[model samples]
Target: MEMVDWNLAVATATRLVRPGPEVSREEARDIVAELRRHAKASEEHVRAFTRMEAANPEDADTPVLVVDRPGWVRANVAGFRELLAPLLGKVEERRASIPGGAVLGAVGGKVTGVEVGMLLSFLASRVLGQYETFAPASRELPGATESGGRLLLVAPNIVHVERELDVDPHDFRMWVCLHEETHRTQFTAVPWLRDHIQMEIQSFLGETEIDPSTLLERLREAAQSLTGAKPEAEEGADAEDEPSGESRGSIVELVQTPAQREILGRLTAVMSLLEGHADYVMDGVGPQVVPSVAEIREKFQKRRATGAGRLDQALRKLLGLDAKLRQYRDGERFVRAVVEEVGMDGFNKVWTSPNTLPTKAEIAKPADWIARVHRKAD
Candidate 1:
């Protein structure tokens, strides 16, 4: 029997509850043990958090930091709590007794810990029927997103304004949360989306290849450029019409091939649509929910304009999520404007099925989208 370590536990639990198995039995036993240990760890973390919350040494207004900041996890919990409240009375009356929200209410003020334990328990209970261990309503960020079916989120340990996702950020940060939550909701609602996202990622990896020599050349060029002496070194040289022709070439050799780039672009476009739709939906709802939205949005834009390095690295390193971010900003405006003109009922019709989503071109131009919506109205 393999000693269950943390890594093995994550792998084992992940594979056990995952859509498919990607490990061996001996390895799996270790994973199972690790999962239990991790759950205990999570519980400990929660207890620590509780102590942190209780100590009250720090400012109450101090911002909170999360290791795993999965959009769906936060959103689902918030949404479920909201969902659970109103229905609680009726349910209790029907049962004639339900222990006053036993597990749930006891878990209050310690929601995060309870939720972590819930996920671990859920993961372990796969021997039973298919119950969502982590659903749209419950998602978490991982130290690594490579694990299959594992919903993961991560953000900086430091943030401006607030923690716990409540501190205001000109609205953009809130919108980000909303967008992330939207992703969670879609996964939870669609059921197929979670599988689809992972499958697409696997497909992308299956085809992706990184060139060694080209990568080295590109690195050298990038390093050289950092010196910032290109113009002075080539002062007497001919005017360089092409921009970074040499460096681009080097990077090109090292990076994904054209065919692979296309694959990447396609994935980026899909992610963009996902992101854009989330933004759009939030816009539709936020005006009614959070008022300082537009100002917050402007602030968020400024952060991006200033080059959010963390965001950039994340997007660049992972399946070109950078492109997705850009596309989303553009797409949000396109979709929101359309919704305003088209009406909610009209726009809602689009999500009737998967095929109805706006294409890449459509996202680029809202006017075209409006025209299509008009045609639909007709």
Candidate 2:
């Protein structure tokens, strides 16, 4: 039995997702066309700044898609389904062992689907763009040589954020494209990267030991942890001593075992590198390409720290987006530090192999990564 009704999830998200800013049909088309052009243009700037070219000629031709909120939800649902297939298969195997498991799954699937939909709907408005690394080859645009991945610029979200930030739409769109395009360049330029991340995800899923019986209870604990509500026993403990969920990391970290945490650390490091490197590239390439980049970055940073409202803040904590914000800051710091110590070419050594990539600890201390990778070379 399926644990989530994928179709239901899609329906719920599309029905509940908030509408984007008002725009005429002609205006929307213009926004999309401009975004597509910016995406293509950003690629050249990113490639030039990073000095990392696609390893394969085919990889260079990766598709750039401009999508609306519902379209973004649909694409992500497909990605989540692909990425979670292994874990879902494991759940199925365990369910088959239980006597009433099929019945439970039948009842639970729709509930899970709605919850997934709600989460996606919340995110649908917030994300500006993304590099969908796990995009299925079957979904690749016809005649595309490399089915490696596609870049998605969420048109509605971009328009919403730029208007909210009160920045130049043209510059803001290109700035957003710069960050996302850097991600596409990272994966394409380093042929092994996609496979490396897939292996890590598979490894992490392989280590999952889910129990159908206690799933709800585990989720309850995770929710409590996210909301900063301590159990009754720890209610009197020092608040400062007990770090909040935002500081501790994501719900994923709260639920994992020690071994799984180790794997998570490695994955976190890789993600930080990717996110940080993109931020670095965007800023590095900004002045020449994106005028008013300074105002955009400043406003964007403030907006990230202070979301719309209490409900939005709580959801960001729950979804681990607060941690994502930190990834951009912390990762950018790491990248900046390394580039300062040793020029851009020297920092490029990170993409040489997985072994050269910084560890979780090293992300916090660039000197450690520089010493380990560069000192050895010297």
Tell me the spans in candidate 2 whose CA falls farther than 4 Å from its real position. 139-144, 225-228, 236-249, 376-378
lDDT of 2 by residue, 1-378 (tens): 588888889899999999999999999989989998999998889999999999888879888878888988888888788888888988887887889989988888888899899889999998899888775756532212554588888999999999999999999999999999999999888888888998898888778768754666668876876577767877766635544333432467556677787898899888998999999999899999988999999999899889798778777777778777878888999999999999999999999999999999999999999989988643
Give the winner by TM-score: 2
TM-score of 1: 0.46
Q: Quickly count the clashes in candidate 1.
A: 15
| lDDT per residue (tens digit) for residues 42-106 in model 1 | 32232232121211222121111222222223433433343333334343343334454445333
The top-ranked prediction according to lDDT is 2
| Per-model CA lDDT versus the true structure | 0.41, 0.85
Clashes in each model (backbone N, CA, C under 3 Å)? 15, 0
